[model samples]
Target: MPSFWSQKSKCLYFYFSGMMTKHKKCFIVGAALIIITNIFTVCVVKLTQDSQSFCPYGWIGFQNKCYYFSKEEGDWNSSKYNCSTQHADLTIIDNTEEMNFLRRYKCSSDHWIGLKMAKNRTGQWVDGAIFTKSFGMRGSEGCAYLSDDGAATARCYTERKWICRKKIH
Candidate 1:
């Protein structure tokens, strides 16, 4: 009877040991899968971040914005129309670099920018932006200020070369 009990004990021990070995294998596999999945997720995130691209031809890239300079001379309304035709809007002056660039090639005259009179308020800029920087008024110059009004309003019908800016993938 004692011998029989010892034999049973050995069998139980062997069974338990086998079960533990299988569990260990399963745990190792699960841990490896978790590690692999984490690495894959990180790679995907980096790839997405690296996929950004600049705008196409005729669009100038500046400070995360693309600008298009129109060689054609037209009124503020027509200039905006032309820009819209090209899937862009009239250039909205936002900073000194943009202002200098525009002034540098000012089409021999003051061209109309995208700035416009606000429909809701007098002298309010309607371009859905607020100008926090001070680009003092080029008085009576009709141009729509991009991001908001720092540039003053001028006559709408004045013909001058213009710029257009757009955002695209």
Candidate 2:
């Protein structure tokens, strides 16, 4: 029969081996959890950064463009000149949504825009797009203004608040 001391030594060795195995499993599981959590946090941060890209301060962002509405009044030509100085142009209404946005956000009832009358008595936008004839522009005045009713032509010298538009960088 084995001596008592030898049997005791075997028991201690087996106990220590089992404990070490359990400890090693626990350590590996904990490490894996930490790595997974870090990866998830990184992914969330990247997604939020992409989604939060926005326009500059004091400008409204819409469809990848920025719009600025002036509080001070200026004539159509003066307003266009002012916008050109800032590397922008008077606001051009391309659709009903843009028209509605301007009407809603305009500082006053009359706001100068980029629309004008061409030599042929036809309406044209500053960007050289021909205005659709369906809008029923009545006056021979060269400049256009946004009013409560809709866009209407006015004399180019008439002073009014203006809207400017530029592309987002």
Provide TM-scores for the models.
0.53, 0.65
Among residues 3 or more apart in sequence or in different chains, the pairs in candidate 2 whose N, CA or C atoms overlap within 3 Å are none
In candidate 1, what are the lDDT values of residues 35-113, reduced to their tens digit?
9999999999887765555666756677676777666678778887898888787777767987776666444444556
Write candidate 2's Cα lDDT for 108-158 as tens digits: 568888889865778888899888864556667889888878888888998
Whole-model lDDT values for every prediction: 0.61, 0.77
How many clashes show up per model? 10, 0
In model 2, the number of clashes is 0
Question: How far out, in Å, is residue 18 in model 2?
Answer: 20
In terms of lDDT, which candidate is strongest?
2
TM-score of 2: 0.65
Off by over 4 Å in 1: 1-52, 104-109, 117-126, 130-133, 141-153
TM-score for candidate 1, residues paired by index = 0.53
- Which lDDT value does model 2 have at 68? 85
lDDT of 2: 0.77
* Pairs in clash, predicted candidate 1: 113-144, 114-144, 115-143, 115-144, 115-145, 116-144, 129-147, 140-154, 141-154, 142-154
